[model samples]
Structure formats: C-alpha cells, structure tokens
Target: MERIEIENLAVQIRAARLEDAGIITRHRYPGEMGEHLAVYEDWLPTVFIGGVYLGWLAQSDGRVIGGAGLLLINWQPSRTDPHPLRGRVVNVFVEPDFRGRGVARSLMQTALAEARRLGLSTLNLGTSEQGRPLYASLGFQAAATEMWLKIKTEHGLSGDSPASNRIP
Candidate 1:
C-alpha cells in the first residue's frame, strides 16, 4: 500500500471525489465486507441526491482506515417550543485496525464543527451498542429508545402519508 502522509490526508479530505465511494463504503461497513461494494452502489447516489456531506476518509499507507458522515434532520415543534428543527449525525465508522487511533474522533470533531458552522442548534444520532461509549464521551445522550417501523407498498407510500408516522 502506498503510504499516505498526514498532510495529504488533509488535502484529500477537502477534495474527495464521488469516485472514492468504494473506499468510504468499505470503511463504513467492515463486518459486512461482502456487501460493501453493492451497498455503496445503491446508497451513494442517494447521498449525493440528498446533498448530505460524507466526511473525510482516513488513509494510511494508501489504504482507507475509516469514514464518517452527517445526516441532516428537521426538528418538529414540541409543546414547550414553537419551532422544532435539528440536524443529525450519522454513518460514523472506523476500521478495526484504526480503532483507538483517534481517526473516528477527528472525523466526528470535524463533523460537529461543520454542523455548528451550518447553524444547527442541536445534533442527534442513533448508535449501535459498540458505538455508544464513543458517542457519550462526545456529549451525546440517549434521549429515548429508538425503534424502526417499515411499511412496504407496491408503489411505496405517497406524499399523503401521515406526518406523525415519520421519525423526527
């Protein structure tokens, strides 16, 4: 593998191209390596379509070590507040070999800074059991238990789907 200088890492972080999807996806889903290539084929275009920001790739010796990204979410109004809109952090991943090396921390810090720069008042994310401690150390709290309910339709739900049915 080609050794990537830390200085080059910074430069690549700024100039990441869509063609780098393979590296990012592999880093994001390590255990499911068999599915990595396919997963990116399906999800990458949507990320671009949705305009989400994929974080920098951690490279060492020209190999991808980790990846991260943010998912923007709108907050809904609560009884106490008239406005409800917020951003969410998502898709944080670090390769096993790179764990504990501060790659994930650096990615997250960059993401949080970007979120703040975007003027988001609050950021939220759901975490796997393995990721909980890292998130907590970064000041993320478990506000509630998260659950997913999927409804399948031949043509998928229409725009008329009830607003309350979606996660906020």
Candidate 2:
C-alpha cells in the first residue's frame, strides 16, 4: 500500500531506520547543554536496532521533512491507567518550510498507531505553546503539574543534587 500526506505532496510517514539516525538527529537539534544528545545520540540507533525505540520519519521529495520518537515508560500507576507503563512521544519536529503542511501531525499519528499496536494505555509529551493546539486536537492533555528540576552542580543545586559526582 502507498502512504501519502497532503493530497499531492507525496509525503511518506515511515519507520525510521538505523541509517536515518543522522537525519533524525539533525532535525531534532537538541538543547544548549546537549547532554541528552551526547548521552543518547548513538543510543538512538542502538534502540532502533534493538526494537526498543521506534522512530517515525516523514519524508518528501527524497528529504526528511519531519520526525518523532516513541518510547515505553514505566511510569507510576494512574487512575486512568492502572498499567505500570505508558508511552512517551518526544522530539517531534518538522522543517520550517514544512510547517502547517501536516508533516508533524503525520509523524505523531504514526507514533500513536505504533503505541496502540504496542498496547500502551496512555501517552504523554512535552510541547511548546505553538504545538499545543495540534497535540490537543489529537487528545493529548497537559500532564498534571508537570515540573522540571535541572540539578546541575554549577547551577547552585545542593551538593546532594542528582547531577553531583563527588560522593559525600
């Protein structure tokens, strides 16, 4: 069967392969610290190779135009989901030129389908305000009081911060 997005655009939303690691990484363009990428960039290929992290890629005209990643997480049990695990949709991105063309949406839909195939009862994501409406339209609600605490030794975090290396 053929996969297409946007009537005549010939976009294909397909499983990203190990060979696509570089292209996917380029699209993600991680944070300033780059620690997440540094620790897990190679691991992307490893997990995909191991069938642990399934990545979705959107391609058009022989170029990667968008992408997203899905991973199973062992989150605490919730009333809505008694299961010990949930799915995480992360690193969603689309080329600037491809915005408003449904490339990101296509990638997300693919990820959701994969999650259902994996029998995940719930899914979650962290998103910017710009992307909120699209995600909300797809049934993603903001997590309750989701918070972030980046404990870096250089950032005045207590010596007991998780990032601290020297043992007390």
Candidate 3:
C-alpha cells in the first residue's frame, strides 16, 4: 500500500484481495445500514479471483477506513459506446470518523483510473441522497428512467406485500 496524504491525513490506498473478502462484506452490510445479502460472502471471493471485480481500500494506521469497488459487466457495444465493457461503482463506504477528509474521493479516483485503464465505456453507481453531491461533483449526472421490480416466487420476500412491488 502506497501512502497518500489527503488534507493532512496520511492514508494508504491499495488494491483489494481475496483475503479481504470478509472485511469488505462487513463494510457492505454494516449492520443496520442496509439489507444483508448472505450470498455475498460466498460470491465475493469468486469475483475477486475471477478478475470480474476490482476494488480499492483506504487504510490509515493499518486499519481500513474506506473502500470502493468496480464491477465490470459485459454489455453489447452500442452506437454511443463502442466498448463492450461497462463498469459499476459499488460498495463505496467511509467510516464516520474519516468522512469529509477526502478518503472517499481518493477511493473513487482510484476506481475511475482502473475503469479507464480497463477500457470501460461507462461507469455507473447508485447513490443515496447524502452521497449525491459527492458523485455529482465527480461528473455523474442523474440517470433518467431508472426503475426496479421485485418478483415474488415460491421463496417469497419476507414481509413483502403486493402493493410494495409497484413502482412509485
């Protein structure tokens, strides 16, 4: 890990590895912050080793303070984008104590650099209200017509009601 000083804070940024899967999974779930995807524990290691996902970690004093992940998805080349690969920026998180100190910004910059190096045509991310400003400042615009649907099957989604499936 090479040390980079951000706003007077010395932080080291490094590429994430398969051994870091457990820590990365915990950061993604963060108890009470979001829904826990139990399968991620098993899936991440495969992705990490398969080269489908590349991630960066920001550490200070030998402890992880922030991180970001870039997932490459295969897509058909369109007229607008001639590249067959698209990148999704995922699981960007910064510890509360490290916020507003350029940790997230550094992590994102690293992710973007990797995307460019990989020849990805477009990079996309889902951001919360609080994270919107930071992403917007990095040249990400609001994507129109984004929507999702949850299909109920035999397994069923816990506490899910039919009304909840409708797009608002």
TM-scores, each model vs. reference: 0.67, 0.78, 0.88
Regions of model 1 farther than 4 Å from truth = 1-16, 33-40, 75-85, 145-147, 152-168
RMSD of each: 7.4, 6.0, 3.4
User: For candidate 2, which ten residues in a row score worst on lDDT?
Assistant: 159-168
Model-by-model lDDT, in order? 0.62, 0.74, 0.82
Q: Which is the better candidate, 2 or 3, if ranked by lDDT?
A: 3
* Candidates ranked, most accurate by lDDT first: 3, 2, 1
Q: Clashing residue pairs, candidate 1?
A: 2-61, 3-61, 75-84, 75-85, 75-86
**For residues 8-120, what per-residue lDDT tens digits would candidate 3 score against the true structure?**
88899999998888778877766533233456767998888889989899999899998899988887788999998899888899999999988998899999888888888
The true-versus-predicted C-alpha distance at residue 36 of model 2, in Å, is 5.5
Question: In model 2, what lDDT does residue 164 have?
Answer: 41
Best by TM-score: 3
Which 10-residue window of candidate 3 scores lowest in summed lDDT? 159-168
